[model samples]
Target: MTLAPRLDRQPRSALLTVVMSIGLIYALLPLVWLIISSTKTQESLIGSFGLWFSGPFALFDNIAQVLSYDDGIYARWFLNTFIYVVAGAGGATFLATLAGYGAAKYAFPGKRLVFAIVLGAIAVPGTALAVPTFLMFSELGLTNTMWAIIVPSLISPFGFYLIWVYAAESVPTELLEAARVDGSGELRTFFTISLRLLAPGVVTVALFAIVATWNNYFLPLIMLNDPDLFPLTIGLQQWNLQAVGVGSQPIFNLVITGSLLAIIPIVIAFLLLQRYWQSGLSAGSVKQ
Candidate 1:
């Protein structure tokens, strides 16, 4: 007979709780500041304490300005960002899911080489590759185009690695063999069987990819010169930059309010996908 170990629940640590509370405050401080600052007028922003509301609440007024200012370029930027996230992040997740599952399941030539290359790529920051990528795209006459952003975003080594590990552990080889014995084609089996098991991993990778692509600044800044093609990150920076050089017109309040509005979608995405993300993270906690 096998004996199970006794499980004892310990009291929660006060020190740990305090540390977490401090970390929570640290993380939320900037967002709180952004929210509060967004409600202030231009002069109130410069005049008042950062954490408190000052003067009249101009959040609605500022939002109106953000949506209407400069012929509503912010709206266009938001649309561009949405397109990039859908194409770039969505493609990255799909390709990563396919590649990772293949790598985890199949034995192919140069598999180790591919793994090594992915690990090396993950170690290298995107900024390091930005210049080389720009030069390559420029040679292909693809610079200043949306493809410049979307194409690079598609190659997510980290996402691929994540799915590879997840698929190997979470997906059962016996189940795959059973499907094959039942005469299911590889494509059909993967789509019908493997994909459902990979759902949590897929959602986690998608969220990461979406956030990365949505918040991408350096890539778009170098790849696109056209203001109309700018995502929210670059567009917001442009608005902030208006304070510099000759004929300076600082719309600091609009910048603050725009920033507040910009983060809403990402927060919404997290809230919507939180369940899947949590499951993905906790999936490996217990041995099956």
Candidate 2:
């Protein structure tokens, strides 16, 4: 009987392993191509195999050119991306956490209505709102400014919804009540007691916000026309456009190198914050 069970499990395990391997390959294939292509020169990129390296490695040279081109404009784009990601994502996470906690824990007038609105907002695609957002920003004379990007990014309905769901399930009513009974103000209780418990959820929401803001292209593209104010995505697109039009432009190399550089910060962030994700998954599993 044990042998029969083992034999049955073997096929299932093998199938799972195969599926996982396929998925991993699919995910990593593009990154591998990027790395290989980044190492190759412009001629090799066109003439050589897509997946393999060819000719002299020009990784350092390509990186240098990417940074030094156009008076180091790529560096400026990098800085703008950092500002948007940090300020926009961080602000969005904070507002979402506060709003979510209120929606989850407190009884207020029209609370359900407020949550419904948030849900509706979450359902609406951000792309759909870009035109209207641009119009509004233009009206307010905020277009082509950093605030134009940061302000719109601050209002993340999905983050709020995630935190709302997490807060309801992960936080204990009794704990808040105990803190209140101990004469702790609501704000203090929220900041000290509840916030600590919500750390995992907060981290998860922040990661989502950061990734969303970092990858955002269309909104910034529409909002800001100034090349100097452009984020990496839009700036890279501009470079790509220039490359296509001009004679003997190193467009392909710049695109590949810039893309690789753009992804580094996000990868580092996920690696560092991944522990919080694991902890969040395991939270509330064991009773204290």
Candidate 1, residues 181-246, lDDT tens digits: the string is: 999999999999999999999999999999999999999999999999999999999888885546
In Å, residue 151's CA in model 1 sits off its true spot by 0.4
Extract clashing residue pairs from model 1.
none
lDDT of each: 0.95, 0.90
How many angstroms is residue 224 displaced in model 1 relative to the true structure, after the best TM-score fit?
1.0
Clash totals, every prediction: 0, 0
lDDT of 2 by residue, 147-260 (tens): 999999999898888788788878899999998889999999999988988999899889889999999999998998998899999999988887777574767898899999
Per-residue error at 97 for model 1, in Å?
0.3
Local error of candidate 1 at residue 236 (angstroms): 0.5
After TM-score superposition, what is the CA distance of residue 162 in candidate 2 from its true location, in Å? 1.0
Model 2 TM-score? 0.92
TM-scores of the models, in the order given: 0.95, 0.92
